[model samples]
Target: MPILEVTKITKQFGGLTANHNISMHVDEGSITAVIGPNGAGKTTFFNMITGVYQPTSGDIKLNGESLLKLKPDEVAKKGVSRTFQNIRLFGEMSVIENVLIGMHTHLKTNLFGIFLNLPATKKEEIEAEKEAYRLLKYFGLESLLNEKACNLSYGAQRKLEIARALATKPKLILLDEPAAGMNPKETKELTEIIKRMGEEFNVSILLIEHDMKLVMEISEHIIVLDHGEKIAEGNPKAIRTNPKVIEAYLGSAAIH
Candidate 1:
C-alpha cells in the first residue's frame, strides 16, 4: 500500500481556494516530486498534509489512518516529517544539536528521568546521539557536528534540515523546495544524495522542487500542479512531453 494517500482534498482561505480537489499517493520506498510554477498552491498542498492547515474538504490518510484534526507534531508522531522551503534551523545550536531536536518526537525520557540521569535515559540519549551522527555523516556534515547551524553554508544548511527531519526516523519525509538556492555543483551533489536517500534510509520521499533537473533525475514519479490543480502525473519521460504540463510552464504559445 502507498505510505501516504491524499484523496480529493481542498483547502480555502475565505474566498481563495488554495487547493482544489487534489489527490495523489506516494508509494513506499519511492522518490516522488510535486512540481509547479510559483503560486501554484504547491506549498498549500504541503501545508494540508503536514497539519499546518486543515483541509476544507477531503481526507488525508497515512498508512490507512486519517490525519484530520491532528496537529503538526501529532502528524510527525504518526510517522510523517518534513523540511521547510525556507530553512528553519536553530542557528546558535550545533549541527548535531539541531538534529537531536528532531529526534524529540520519539525520545521517551521525561524531565524527571533526564534530571536524575537514570541509566535508561542515559542509554537512550547515547543511542540518539549516535543516530544523529549517522544522519549527519550521510549528509557529510558529521565532521562539523559541533558547528553552529547558522554558520553552515546555504547548501549544508539545507542538508542539515533534511538530516534533522530524518532524525525522526519517519516512514515518510516531505521536502519543500530543497534545492532552491544551491549552485550547480551543490545541486548535482544533492541530486545524487536524494537518488540514494530512499533506500539508504528506508523511507519514502515526497518533495516540491523547482529544479527540473533534480526533479527529473531523482523522481520515480512526478505530480504536476498548475493553479492548485493536478494537471498531469507520470514518470519523468511522460511528464516531460505532457502537453498540459508544457502549457502550464511555458504557455499556449509554446505548445503551438
Candidate 2:
C-alpha cells in the first residue's frame, strides 16, 4: 500500500471551496511534489492531511488507517509530521530545545514522574536529549545547540524546522514551501537534504513548492493544481510538456 492515500478529498468554508475532490497517493520512500501558482489550494491540502482542517468529503489513509478525524497531535503520533509555509519555530527557545519538543510523542515520562524526579523519568530525559542532539548533528546544526532559534541564519532556520519535523520519527513528512525565502545556495542544500531525508532516513515527502527548479529536480512524481483542482500528475518530463499544465500555470517559457 502507498504510504498515504488521499481519495477525492474536498474542503469548503461555507460557499468558498478551497479544494475540489482532490486525489493523490504518496508512495513509500518516495518524494512527491505539489505545485501551482499562489491560491491554488496547495496549503489547504496540507492542512487537511495534517488535520488542521476537516475535509467536507472523502477519506485520507496513512498506512491504510483513516486520518480524516484525527487531531493534529494525533496525526503526528500516527507518523505524520510537517513544517509550515512560514517559519514557525519557538523563537525564544534554544535550537535543541525546539527539536526536543518534537520528540514529545515518544517520551515515556509522565508529569507525576517528573514532579517527583523518578529515575525512569530522568533516564527518559537523558535519552531524549541524546536523540535530539543526534538529530541536530545529522542536520549539521550541532554547534548551534545553545543558540536561540530566532538567532539562526535564514537557511539554518529553515533546516532547523525540517530537523524538528524529523525528530517526530514520522513515516511521512509534508513540507509547505520550504524554499520560499531561500537563496540559491540554500535551495541547493535543501534539495540535497530533502533527497537524503527520503533515501537515508526512509521518510516519504509531500512537498508544496513554487520553485520549478527545485520541484522538477527533486520530485519523483509531480502533481499540479490550479484554482483548487488538480490539473496534472506525472513525472517531470511529462509534466513539463503537458499542454494543460502549461495553460494552467507553467507557461511555455518555464520548461527550460
Candidate 3:
C-alpha cells in the first residue's frame, strides 16, 4: 500500500515552473529516493509534499487522503514529518529539548492543563520526556542529552535532526540530503541506520540524496528528476543501468 501519493504535481513561481507535472508514490514501510543534479526541482518537490509550498496543480495524498489544501503544520499533524536539506536544529536548545519540540503536534495535554499542572498533564509530560530520551539513545546521544545542539559535532547534529523527526512517529518521513556533509564513516553508519528505521520506527522513508552509494545500497525504489521533470524511476539495478538517468543525473559511470 502506498503511504503517500503525488499525482502530476506542479509548482510555478510566476512564469517559472520549478516542478513540471511530476508524479510518484512511496509504498508503506519502504525506503525510496529522489535523485538529480542541483536545480532539478528536487527541493521544490519536497516542499510541495511537505506543504511548505502548495502545488499549482494536482494532488498529494497521505493514507489515501488529500493533503493538497493543508499547510505545513496541518500536514505534520496528519503524520508527515521532514528534515531540511540544510540541518535546521534549535542550536540554542538542549538536544533532548529539541526532540521534545517535535512531539508538540501530537501532544495530548492542552496548554490550559499544562498551565494548571493537572495530574494528566504531568503524566503526559513525563511520558514525552521518556520518549524523547529513547530517541536520543537511539542515536547514541543519550550521553549528551543536556548539551546545546550547537555544541555537538556536525555528524551528531545530523543524526539529531533525524531523531527529532522520528519523534513525531510519522507515517512518512522525508529526508532532504541527509548525508550532505558526512564523512565516509558517518555515511556508512547512516546507511545501516536508515535501512533499519522503517521497521524500528514504523515509518516509510523518502529521501533526496546525491550519494549514489547510499541510495543504491538502501533504496528499494529510485526516482530521477532533471530540469524540473522526471527522467527515470526504477529499482536499484534498473536505475543504475538506465541511460536517461545516467545522462541526466547519475552520469555514464553510474553503471558498475
lDDT of 3 by residue, 1-256 (tens): 9999999999999999999999999999999999998999999999999899999999999999999879999999999999988899999999999999999888998979978999999999999999999988888899999999999999899999999999998999999999989999999988998998999999999999989999999999999999999999999999988888888854566534
Look at candidate 3 and give me any clashing residue pairs.
none
Pairs that collide in candidate 1 are none
Q: Tell me model 3's lDDT, rounded to 2 decimals.
A: 0.93
Per-candidate TM equals 0.97, 0.96, 0.97
lDDT of 2 by residue, 228-249 (tens): 9999999999999999888876
Candidate 1 regions off by >4 Å? 251-256
What TM-score does candidate 2 reach?
Answer: 0.96
**lDDT, model 2, position 81:** 97
Cα displacement (angstroms), candidate 2, residue 221, comes to: 0.8
Candidate 3 — worst ten consecutive residues by lDDT sum?
Answer: 247-256
- Model 3 root-mean-square deviation: 1.2
lDDT of every model, 2 decimals: 0.93, 0.92, 0.93
- Give lDDT for model 2: 0.92
